[model samples]
Target: MTTHRRLVLALQPDMLAICRLEPTAYIGNDVLNGNFVAITKTDEELSIICPQENMPEEAIYTKGWRCLRIEGPFSHDTSGILASVLAPLAEAHLSVFTATTFDTGHVLVKEENLNRAIQILTQTGHVVRSENKATVPYAIQ
Candidate 1:
């Protein structure tokens, strides 16, 4: 088995929501203004990840997810960054929703699982830091 390098991840401050809309549903301005938003449209659905407060009432959504952003502007050729983080979480039986930007990867775990997820990541040698004071107590040494 290959050993992936340890990484530092930043926990974003907002509580996000994941929404599913009809394949051709219109994405409004509310979602566009979020601190972090990801939208994807496929033949079956239009999926949106954004701050909970910005989600549209008509969309079917799951709320109270917290995002962990892998710190990087990694070169396109770089590999294993996300797997390293995800493998550990999967082993612990945690479900995650993931998204990737050109620069980094984001993992969203339900709010209730946030502390345990951070602990698991830290145990596996990854560092998770948060600017949100609410998460400060859970930061592992």
Candidate 2:
């Protein structure tokens, strides 16, 4: 039997950056000013994700990435959400970077591969929607 999940995913319209800094590095105004920013400090490094335009030069980061927002206020107990999203991508050999906020999950794939990622997801029975009409899923069966 094939199990299926239907999710409403929205692709964020802006390009994003993944920034990395020393563990003790100061968080700057630029990162804070980003439209959407996620920061994590571990023993080795401080990692940040934010709108590409707001990233500072001091941080070592990757640019030209786009995000897919899983639309939800998913219950804390919900299981397999990320697994469901990731399995097909893994099978297709597409690499993704993921993060989760209190309400939802964000998946980032390089800009060059966005269309292919959407096509792979749609083929696996997920709806991939974007800010513009162009990236809408074609047919999922």
Candidate 3:
């Protein structure tokens, strides 16, 4: 079996809800449903937002936020901290949203799952801090 090297990076404690939204120059913003959304351009290349189901299977979920950045001194294979953080939520049947920048990994859980996610992360030895509103820890989910 080939073992993949885990990237080392810092994570912050900020659980944000990944809201697939329709934000327009005309209407400003319209909140889409919980899971996924798709945007397409018309004949003139005009962008339009639509529910994800209507799009092709190849469509990917865009918009990454409502996540806590796992803080640094990161060495991927060190102790499996990353996996520790993710594993519990998966077992809890909560969906996780994630993205990786060159510097760190962002783990996004649902807004409703924010508290439980933080609790799980803390219980597992990973540190976390909610953004100022410290209670819920994210924008509208």
How many residue pairs clash (N, CA or C atoms closer than 3 angstroms) in each of the candidate models, in the order given?
A: 0, 0, 10
In the range 45-130, model 2's lDDT, one tens digit per residue, is 99999998888678999998888888798999998777777788788788899999999898898988788888877887888886
Clashing pairs in 1: none
TM-score, cand. 2: 0.88
Global lDDT of model 2: 0.81
User: Per-residue lDDT of 28-141 in model 1, one digit per residue for the tens?
Assistant: 887887678999999999999999999978999999999999889899999898899999899899999999999999999999999999998888888888855333336433
Over the stretch 17-127, how does candidate 3's per-residue lDDT look in tens digits? 222323332312332432322233434332322232332233334322345656555555465545666676676777886654444456666556666776665554555
Once superposed on the true structure, which residue ranges of model 3 sit more than 4 Å away at CA?
1-65, 73-81, 131-141
- TM-score for all models, in order of appearance: 0.91, 0.88, 0.46
Which ranges of candidate 1 are over 4 A from the true structure?
A: 132-141
Indicate the worst ten consecutive residues by lDDT in candidate 2.
132-141
> Evaluated with lDDT, which candidate comes out highest?
1
Give me candidate 3's TM-score against the actual structure.
0.46
Error of 3 at 76 (Å): 6.9
